[model samples]
Target: MHDHARGLSSGAHRRPLAVSLALTAAVFAVQVAGAILTGSLALLADAAHMMTDAAALVVALFASTVAARPADERRTYGYQRAEVLGALVNGVVLIVLCVWIAVEAVGRLSAEAEAEIAGGWMLAVAAAGLVANLVAAWLLRHAQKQSMNVRGAYLEVLGDLLGSVAVIVASAVILLTGWTRADAIASLAIAVFIVPRAIGLLREVFSVLAESAPRGTAVADIRAHILGAPGVRDVHDVHVWQLTRGAPVFTAHVVVDREVLDGGGAAALLTNLQECLADHFDVAHSTFQFEAVGHEDRHNAHR
Candidate 1:
């Protein structure tokens, strides 16, 4: 009744993700050392962010690997949802990191005596971190479009890149103006910028977990197209949802003219229906139950 079409595997993204992970890991160590020596809150916050980015990349890489496994009887859809779960975890972690950064920034701002930051040391380390983040971001840029898991990692690295820039600017301000609070202010700005993106990613993850139709996809529009198929009288109980990004599934009960079934045109009608979905909606996996008009009336249990 339905075509079996596997979701696109995440294997293609693994190499770039691995490279980015290495780059982030190396930058994290350097930034941590710099933060300790400079006593710069902004540098410390960026280091923490980089550490989390490395972890997120690891999770994304593992999830993508698991998601490439073939479907079996026990797990008919294979492990495509693993990518979404990975993305969900990354999104939550990002929000938590932001909260920590915000709280620390506030505490620093309220203190009677500000921490003495070595702006020259902070700026040197921050510039190095910025260059590393830029390379990682470029590596994952194209891959992010194909998988939510990769997108989550890409966003984290991009945030880290921005954080590095903020640290550099803060350090420059402190060096030139002797304003110690610039470090705290920069940390606050980085936290503020990351929270919204984390929220947006979480919203997308929840929508998938809820079995909602993919974004920009309208159920009403799908129903209209189904009704347009030759021999189809009406469609009911139509449903659409996604297993992951770019992997949509559809199902419906289609009422057709009795003559079409009796005259042995059912096969052609089914093909037309399936092809209509494939060509117009880009949905390759669909199921349809064909019944002669009024068959639902006899059952009396249709939704």
Candidate 2:
């Protein structure tokens, strides 16, 4: 018997992404203008990060829309995994952007001639970016918990927030100490901060794509629960994995006493198993194959 229990769709996060995207676009423009005016590598790096954040939000928004599509014959599971793909792209883009920033910062650091930095304009622009990132981060904070796509955008915004702070600090150091190298140092700091988060996000996206069991779900405990159910003698061939961020799917084979089938209790047994999965494991979709004792011997022989 198989039971399909639906969960909330990804569409709920669209508004947050849209709003964040608008804010990010505006910030990116301001940062780019500031970078050009101040000749500050740190400001330019933050603008680059903001550009990626804007792109990530756009991808996340599109993925949420695609993921909300209904299942059909050709695509029985629908488009829920689109969010995972969106996250993957976001992670890759962030890492690539960081690599570019790191190389540029190194070149600036090695140059003998100090690049003149307009500290006042850089500080003002970075402060504006900090405020915008804070607002965008607040908007997506909750939705990020529900969707990986939103989480990717949220992470990008957070990186941008840190980048803004780094730029502000670099501007201050330049303004107060007249140290131009601080601008390159701050760009390197932003790159260092972002790479770990991007790698972590990629690791999660890969885990989901690989169909590994969702984190925190114990397969052994789930098996024990199934064995504890009434009229079940043994269980095997268990599998559990997630289709997306919060949707877990499960399957198992059960060996049942012959009396349960002969006495017309199979339906009740299936219902009990479904309820066990839904209630205890929070597994909304599950499939169980019931068989008489010694069936595994035959199944193994065939295998």
Cα lDDT computed for each candidate against the true fold: 0.90, 0.91
Candidate 2 clashing pairs?
Answer: none
- Tell me each candidate's TM-score: 0.94, 0.94
lDDT of 2 at 163: 91
User: Ten consecutive residues with minimal summed lDDT in candidate 2?
Assistant: 294-303
Clashing pairs in 1: none
Q: Where does candidate 1 stray beyond 4 Å?
A: 5-7, 297-303
Candidate 1, residue 84: CA error in Å? 1.1
